[model samples]
Target: MGFSKLFIFLFILQTLLAMALTQPTDQKTNIFREYIGSVSNNVTFADVPINPNVEFHYILAFAIDYTTSSSPHPTDGKFDVFWDTHNFSPSEVTAIKNQHSNVKVALSLGGDSVKKEKCYFSPFSVDSWVSNAVSSLTKIIKEYNLDGIDIDYEQFHADPEIFAKCIGKLITTLKNNGVISFASIAPFDDDEVQSHYLALWKSYGDIIDYVNFQFYAYDKGTTVYQFMNYFHMQSSNYEGGNILVSLTTEGRGGLSPENGFFKACDMLKSEGKLNGIFVWSADTSKGLGFRYEEQSQALLAVSHLHSLV
Candidate 1:
């Protein structure tokens, strides 16, 4: 082969190799999985392995607890970050990230258990629970080379004002320190979490990178119109970048991946109103055979390609 032809062939080979190694980010699809609640029976992290064909913007680890009055984190600003291996393990995390080199391995903080007042909006405090949560979060992000943090504070009943302050300050700190590339919230269709987020966005929306808004759990019998309508309603509160259309696996049924769920996603993608899809869980879905892990990426990819045309 001539030198010029040889150069072209080598370049093509290198490009193909790069594609096999990592996922493309720009003008591509975004899919996320939340490792929350419980994984399916006998389904270990290795059970539902990362599909090389799929690319994920985030694979959120279900959660880490906050230092509460009952279960305090650490006063000396040290946090273990991991325990009860069921939630996560080091090797499992590595495997997930290795699939998509740019995949953001984020940690979800809080759930039904995290107490606000008891922890002073923990992630924002210092030398106390703040130290505990932040220090631990720092440790994990570095240790695992994780990407970001997602706040899944389920206690919307708490003061939205306090919640907003905590959220605003926390994201600001995380982004400023360059410890996390993104920060997100997992909120539902109610005014509880919404109110707090609204308060935060009123002044500090820039700090928030995404909102994995839960479309299931609360919204029963969700139709395509209902799903789009919710997007319209929520998008008013946040920007296009912050809104991620999320669905459930083990919800009140009907609103599933193969059910009306993908239908809703299709409409959103067509209208260009979707950031991406967020599955409420990984394990439960795997157990129930509610698999859309690869489909989510494929759907988004098709949607994106159509938008270009």
Candidate 2:
């Protein structure tokens, strides 16, 4: 072959070989970019973009107490009656489903005030309460197509054993029909309550997908030190699987997302035992309540932690 032809041939061969080696790496990079783009686009009021590599604890189905006394009450104006007909708006529920497809949104049944009234009846009660609850929830699921249900039966403090049985029944029924179930539990600080908590956990573990610890009420402070102490204590005590550490972004002495909340999440990630993070209510942020941008930064901060894996 001529010298010029030989030189051209060698150069072309080298270029082809280099392109072949780099193709897979370049394709992977592109795929990752696309995946991240898809996730970012999916951000909504209910969920923030989580790192695809890390499995996030379930994003709480931001709850609004639809009972009688809530700001926007149903026409009947009775807590139980109102709950039967009124629930979250279709748009609000849609926002949750769109934002976090993989995450579960458990409809929290009761709130602090709801518990005070002793409104929750036994799970075995043949009263209209269970039927009403199930019907209301079914409407929500059908309308918003929620991933799961969260029974926040705070009223059950008086008779938690019976309450637990009721909750277990509800959970079993939901799971058998292919729905997820989560239970939002009070803090287990006292020895007596700790025993009850353990019993409930043991009994409901099969039916309950996860337990969200109301960590904020127990650990009210402005610093990471206080939050961490509370978190560690709870983790040490509760040796259960998929225990989610929760905090409130609003309400009495709640932690702001920018404050120690993100730091606490990082701390949990470092420990290699973090399941997920839950914000109390989406309706109660400082300025832009539950909007994507306001919550996005907080989620991004959690996603950035290298130790999340």
Candidate 3:
């Protein structure tokens, strides 16, 4: 072949190799995550049953950028622990992880409301918010020995780009500093919320580890067919992302386990799309006897084993 032809061939090979390296895989994993501490249910880490077969994660419900005083006001970018420290303290985090070898702990940021007022992503500026967030969150993560962080800012006081820049920078800084091993964004199907998260995904998707889409936030009577379609829709929305299937123990919304959540999970598992599963909270599950938690982990474990077969 001529020199020019050889150069073209090598370029095509390198392009294919890069595409193979960058593309996301659909391999299923036996990973289960749950949000704890947000509901202030006096629930402790030990209360939840742990399945050793699955990689379990207990994500503390929230560490909001707000004050924990009586009024509970926002602090621009500064974050403070708003979780149920009475039961789920930093020490509890350490104890749980130490007890369960397959367990990891993460914290979510910006829950729905604070003191009846909406918790907005009202960062004063991207630079300042990221700086304050990094400083405050790093202290909390180190103190708790947490493994990851989740973004759950439901309401946004800023535009899409501003929200994107603030969160994108925050995740980037935390990962770069080795403060956290993984990070996730908890986005629901709302138009406004999706816009902001999509903006973040568009800009810094490579750095993001997971898209913890809140499918439970959908209407309460969602069917198995609707659930599967929703999952596919979101899979398309956040393309090439490990979107975890979610449910709420509070019976608030989405497809309840009694209504075929695990069945949907089994379907996803068969297609190798069941990357992971997470729940809205451990707080409610504690009162409900944690049967669904047991079921979820069992399904994930069985799915993992079957996948190997």
Candidate 4:
């Protein structure tokens, strides 16, 4: 071939290569973009095996303990209260990032056993609490490069109006600062709670990205199926797809993933209300030394269903 022809061919090949390089690879998916995934079943610096085929969209790490009293220590006394990003070095965060590149890591703030007083009490009086939370969250995100924040405050009944307003403000502030914000709320079977709070959440839907409904811990007065039916019935009224339903496998008043959780997901999917599933905490179900294999299997089952769909 002539030298000019060879040069032209090389230029075309280089252009093709440049285009391929600019395109995103399948492994490095978008993080800020919404997707389905599991909550981190093991929050500690342990070897947690994540399914490669199933994209782990969100992995929530436990940070501050907003509970009223001191948290309970395991037999080893490893994960005590006051455990946050400060306790875990940069290496721990790096380990999680390495495991799942597409995962959005959000730091959770409260737990079910938390005392109402320890929560944001100024929700009724001052708006500074929102600023304080935003400041702390921004610091954490800057430090660890997290994707967003998850508000796990369990004191929903203390001051619903002020609490919702504070949440709306916090979410708006976070979004304005280029961060995503989500809240975990209690599930309702009757219209009593929903009548008051559901409207508030709907009104502020533009600010809040998603809401993880705690469908467990409800009164299992009847069979598990009956309880799940009641939960589904309540969720029917609210906007469906944006809601994430969480199930607990082991706790004082918990439901097994096999019976309550899987069934609940199936029910939601049938009604076109299922968005995703989030386990309560890594320590409670899989992190602690009990029923690890069972929880793993349950998670695998969910992942498998996602694959088929």
| Best lDDT among the predictions, by candidate number | 3
Worst 10 residues of 3 by lDDT: 19-28
146-199, model 4: which lDDT tens digit per residue? Answer: 666665554344356665676667667777878653444433443545543565
- The global C-alpha lDDT for each of the candidates, from Candidate 1 onward, is 0.61, 0.46, 0.86, 0.48
Q: Which stretches of candidate 3 lie over 4 Å from their true place?
A: 1-28, 68-73
Which of 3 and 4 is the better model by lDDT? Answer: 3
Task: List model 1 lDDT by residue over 1-309, tens digit each.
Answer: 999999998997777656543544542245555554334254454445344434455454444544444333412333335323554566666776675464556777665432233222333343244445565677777776777888766554346766676556667776788999877777776666677667767767777777777777555676766667777888886764458777666666336554577888777776766666777676567766545765676676555444433
Q: Give the per-residue Cα lDDT of candidate 1 at 292.
A: 70
Clash count, one per candidate: 1, 2, 0, 2
- What residue pairs clash in candidate 4, if any at all? 67-114, 68-115
Residue 171 in candidate 4, Cα distance off native in Å:
0.6
Candidate 2 CA-lDDT value: 0.46
lDDT of 1: 0.61
